[model samples]
Target: MLPLESRRDMKIYTFENRTIDIRAYSSAGGLFTALAEIVLNKGGVVYGASFDEDWSVVHRRIDNVADICHLRGSKYVFTDINGCFSQVCADLKDGRTVLFSGTPCQIAAVRKKFGYHENILLVEVVCHGAPKKEYWSLYLDELLKNQGKTQDEIASINFRDKTKGWKNYSVCVEFKGGSRFIQNHRDNLYIQAFVHDYTLREGCTKCPFKNPNSKADISMGDFWGIEALAPNIDNNLGTTIAIADTAKGESILDSIACRTYFSVEQVAQYNPAIVKSPSVPLDKPEFDTTVKAEGFHYAAAKFLKPVFDSRDRKMSFRNQLRSFIYRVYSFIKNR
Candidate 1:
């Protein structure tokens, strides 16, 4: 079975130097505004991934809260950053108050690269896991192929549309063909396969970053129960469940003055499942045999063959087919 498929409840915790609750908040805008406010107050730049002209990933700095809008609806898995952890470590060593946001794995990579720093505030999103980058590339390639357009023909892409509800998020692709394709989530088969864990990184299946004891100061996730608890808050607009994992997180939240926010209980009614589920152990092996080259391809092929075809194909036809279907569906639905 896939790792995430386990019906086990994920554990989330709040820590403080002394306080019990550690102070929680709700409201997506309030959460972002709070984080942005703290960064600006410290004269520190908020460094996170943002979309560039090519629709690829790049790290960007935001000096003002208004710039936070650029990061809204960013996919939890894929980040728009160049280089790897080494580059990120170089930036952190410069001693800037930086807010790094990404999936738990990427955040863990950054922490592994730079170690823990008081000035660095790591904010991790609650992620299931990221799909393979190759899958994404192939999916986009197929999309352009189906649309009769080249990479140069694409103007831009937006994965999530705020105007629409989260379940119906659409992928807006503007083609050089001067045509636009706003594919709905349901029409995309690639997305379905991905959600079903057909294209996740092998490491992700046994991820090391699923730790509630994470080094992040603050962790954020969609407030699944926003409507039921904070009925006053705009549930359709989305809300973030901000948990303070450190004193720095509390300090940051205390400094911001914005829209109304609430405690964890305020939104607990919306998601009893996650609230009651036990946290999984974060310990994981160094590598998974399925995706690693050193592992037996025949054994891996045996498990994946049923999904596609288990022939002695060089590229592994079964795996590739599974990947292709997942990529196409994910690009359309999850984006």
Candidate 2:
């Protein structure tokens, strides 16, 4: 029931020019990296999710600006906070500046635990609910098995590889031996699981942090439909949609060196998760059972069949319409 930007001073923003390398490494525009860089330049530390050696996403801390790349991109998998809350508290207690970015739930916990600390700035990713870590593990196992690789052979996993541009991003897996597996997002089973709600947590089906309730100073997400919403600024690469809830958030956004600023009111039209939780897929129960017994691919096969079928049906209809129009033109010309 809360308004989108409940605060009178809340503002929206998007990158004007382009962040070339930054956008390439990021899931969206490199706004998080920019914000972290600002904090680091001011002698502050940043806490956010990063992949560990085993590729499990977990919250980590870094004070150096160069390491911000490690924190970029989207990890749909669950991220273990791993006692980082206490570390943030320690930093704040010592009067050190801190920039923390996480899912709404994590940010809410930080806000509750730290309580409007002057030295701490809170940022939250506009999340579509996190999937279970176990699901991600299973998917990774299947991925490595299919690629004829093992845990030791893998170098890195990127859920959002913007090489083909960010709109329809790819899931990239780099091997230690120098080969890479870059699968289109449409074909990525893990993304399908996350998007279709098969792997999302039960609580995420009805998330508690929608709007007018978030304590985060800034909320950032991929502007999915920016091309249609704001065609002039659309680069077909990655563009970030940022909502600044406090003056501090606005100040941090202003510090982003080279970004064009613009406000959007209908962001939810593209990013629905901003205002509501994605409903649990009806087939999730079957999906879970199939995945647990057979594997991720097996479950995906049975479920994704409908998606392919729908696409085929739509294509067939379009083809039929085109043929009909051509025939009609031929008849008129002959007459």
Candidate 3:
């Protein structure tokens, strides 16, 4: 179950940005850019996730926009948070205004590590969950092999490419020679598995931070149902939903270049992840076991076999409770 403090009390907004060169992973409405602008305006360093050479996501810090331009989009994999918290603490101790952006749990960990620092601004993304690193690493290898490309030839990868518009977004990958490969999410087997809730990390299935009230100053995510609620808003590119959880968050939001504040209910109605955890698929354990015994491709084939099968459906309350108990027991046993 989610923590009660994270249940309600938030201010929503629609944000957009057309100036920067849009990347594959960047969501519509320039939400991250808006947050980066705040750090820049305050002469602060921005801490965000960046992809490593092997396509793994790692936390990084940047002081200039040009250097941090690639930190725009989603990576969809478990991020390496090593050194990020310590760096933020060191910077804040030196009196720097640090904007640390990541998933809700990452922000929560940082908050717990530093306790309430006035100089630190925590911004969490509305997350579906971090997919397993091993699965993603294997999936990328398959893509590279299918394309006949070497790892060194790859320049960048974007999970939220908007070439086909926001709603039908595709994954975009660029090689060093400027050649690009774009795959619609629907056509990608790995993405299909991810969206179906098969490869997600265990912690995400029972997220404690999946609530509106946040320890961070602000929370942001894709404003999914923008077209239905605000007909005037241009969602062709994409729209961002920013929720202010603190006075400082609200104050910083008012200064963003292009944003319009709206009621909290507008966000809750569209994105259920705001109030409750996403349902875990029934075949999750089998999916994990198959991935370990066979390969990602084989496991994906098994996962795609049928949609109506009972084992593929969401877990029941009894199962969820049992899983939680097992997780707690395992944690204690490991300790």
**Strongest candidate by lDDT:** 2
Q: Local distance difference test, per candidate?
A: 0.54, 0.81, 0.77
What's the CA error at residue 126 for candidate 3, in Å? 0.4
What is the Å distance of residue 231 in model 2 from its true position? Answer: 0.4
Residue pairs in steric clash, candidate 3?
A: 16-29, 24-161, 25-73
Query: Between prediction 2 and prediction 3, which has the larger TM-score?
Result: 2
lDDT of 2 by residue, 1-335 (tens): 11234464455677532557887788887888888877899999999989888888889999998899889888988776758988987888778999999998888888888877788888999988999999888888898898899888888889998788788789999998799999888877788768877788888877887654677888888887787777877777778888776667776677663333343347777788888898878878888899889998889878888986787799999999999999999999999
TM, every model: 0.62, 0.90, 0.84
Q: Least lDDT summed over 10 consecutive residues: which range in candidate 2?
A: 1-10
- True-vs-predicted CA distance for residue 266, candidate 3, Å: 3.7
Q: Which is the winner by lDDT between candidate 2 and candidate 3?
A: 2
- Whichever of 1 and 2 has more lDDT, that candidate is 2
Alpha-carbon RMSD of each model: 13.5, 3.5, 13.1
Better of 1 and 3 by TM-score: 3
Error of 3 at 262 (Å): 4.9
Q: lDDT of model 3 at residue 149?
A: 95
> For model 1, how does the per-residue alpha-carbon lDDT over 1-335 read when each residue is reduced to its tens digit?
01222222322332111111111111233355456556767766676666666555555667676676555445423653546454546656776577777766677776666655767777876565665565566566667777778888887566654436543566677776568878665444445445445556666655655434455666666666555555564435445665555666655544542224454454345543223332322221322333344332332333444444323463577789999999999999975
Model 2 residue 335 CA deviation in Å: 14
lDDT pick, better of 1 and 3? 3
List the candidates ranked by TM-score, beginning with the highest.
2, 3, 1
